[model samples]
Target chain A: MRFRFTGIFDLFNQKNEYYLINKKLDTIIQINESMYKVLSNAKQGTELNCNEINLNTMNILIYNRVLEAIN
Target chain B: MKRDLNKPIVIHWCMNNCNKQGQIPKGVIEGKIRQAEPIKIRFINPRSQEDWRIIESFANESSDIKEIQVEYDFLEYDIKHCIDIDIEKKLIYLVAFSGTSYLDHDARNRLCNMIKKQDNFKIIVYISHKNIAESVCFIQSVYNEVKQGEFIIKPEKNIKNELTDISVLHEAISQIAELYKLFPDIKLSVYDEEKIVRDIIRLPYYMYGNMYITGDGNISMYSFMPAYNYGLSDPQVTLEEAWRKLYHEHATCDLEKILEYPRYWFKYFNRKEIK
Candidate 1:
């Protein structure tokens, strides 16, 4: 279904690699360009269709608890 | 000409290998210099071995420099020699990191005794990312030591990275804000709305009547960002000439336009709820 990015995370690009830094957990996880684009465009509390992103990658992100489903 | 003591004079201590060293022109100190008002000088938290050696050497070169007060960093190096000489003078102990945790109870007691003896002294704790409860307890331990002195908690700046997360920065601001509630008397360097707006029209606080003396003896009107270079301090330039150049050049730039950038604007402006 639809999903949104977490508010506790900060997105940044360093050395051509994109990282999501979770301030609450003090953790950083690197993601690919496609994931970066999707996350960057997804506003907090807004829903994004699963078809908008690669289903396999989206599954991995949700599994890792980086992205949460809104509906 | 005698300088007025009432006016504020801010001095920035720089080491020889400072990043701005290359920017200073050579042989700028050959001319006669003007004398300014006599102000008390203090050195704060000099860390590097090279910096310490240069400071020691600089002090030895001039007896006047040796008399200047200092706030020694207990975490960096042994300040026994500095304490021995300036025992009677105003001393400051800057505790950063988990510096207090490293000291044994007896040593901590001795340190407090030394601080209590000084007529004018301060214990400034630089807040860091360490556990807040542990940090507060460390401060309280030293608090029990001194009878009368200023205890300040300052938020440390994140100077390394140009881009800092807004959330992280706000968290730091909130933490330091809470300290004011605990110790109402503590002073902070952050600007209020009045100060920020005042600076927007005029020069920022750091630029006002300030002089930076680098380790190589070069002088600049502004410490980190000098609009105009005043050359070396050895040959000596008049404080009037330096101020004139700094004020004149700084006035020409549109600070408002400069402040419009997200990073600069964010520093002075805070969002408040409309309700």
Candidate 2:
């Protein structure tokens, strides 16, 4: 596998769900790297070491991508 | 007659103790050489372990096991330089207990050195030992995580329960796959239930993700973050209890198809940059 230095999911779709989104809607999503540059380096309710995805978006992540996947 | 010359050779670094107890299940060693057409297996067992001797005694010459060698802790040596790494068919399966896979500064350094010397070879290393992930890592309770259908962790202990959970998880992963398919890095590990005693007297405790998911029925998904030099939290996955049911009275796959559900994008910060 290629070494992903800064991106976790890199905006990719997974075959499985990380967890359920409808139920997991409350959870936060994490982003860093160029993707973070786009996301502004944030994950959920709080401003993590990175940034917060203060707003919702359209996407999918199996496991780590669970909540991030849901639109 | 011993082995198809066509197959490349794969070595099993049994070390004396580990391989001594285990023998290559006959047909596998032979048929795999033919069908998989990869390589013949070279069994390396330490001559000292009498327990392993008993297992090897069971094998006959017809088994087609190549040469048997003694002595070599895989961890200590730079295997790549010695082995014919050029042989694309070569695969190494290492099985040693705390003696080899232990997490110490010295041992870790040795292992890192060996791995660093590694080239294009497909190396598979197995840490043979008791399940100590519970004590060594931080395990936390995670509520119903159905999104990624399957959680990643080193599978250890409580098999009877893990199997049941896995079957369900598999189905969920399948569903998720249908929606958004494709992921790299898939791993599967098998354990020996050969010595485990099953009780027919009474049914073991089993629950479907309930508040009290009987101890026997849960699997810990340990998160090993590459970014973090240390380990990440390992969360428990007890399906029913963790997840609240999504009661969407109606279905909408057609809508999902039209929308072409977007993939989740997770950005990562350089480990050094993150404070």
Candidate that would win on DockQ: 2
- Residue-pair clashes per prediction, in order, are 1, 35
| lDDT on C-alpha atoms for all candidate structures | 0.46, 0.25
* Candidate achieving the largest TM-score: 1
Model 2 lDDT, residue A67, Cα:
31
lDDT (C-alpha) at residue B108 in model 2 = 46
DockQ of 2: 0.02
Give the per-residue Cα lDDT of candidate 2 at B24: 31
Candidates in order, TM-scores: namely 0.48, 0.23
Give one digit per residue, the lDDT tens place, for model 2 in B64-178: 3332222234454444443444431233334232212445566445444443343311122221123333212211111011111112222222122232244643543343343
Candidate 2, true inter-chain contacts retained: 0.00
**Model 2: lDDT of residue B39:** 15
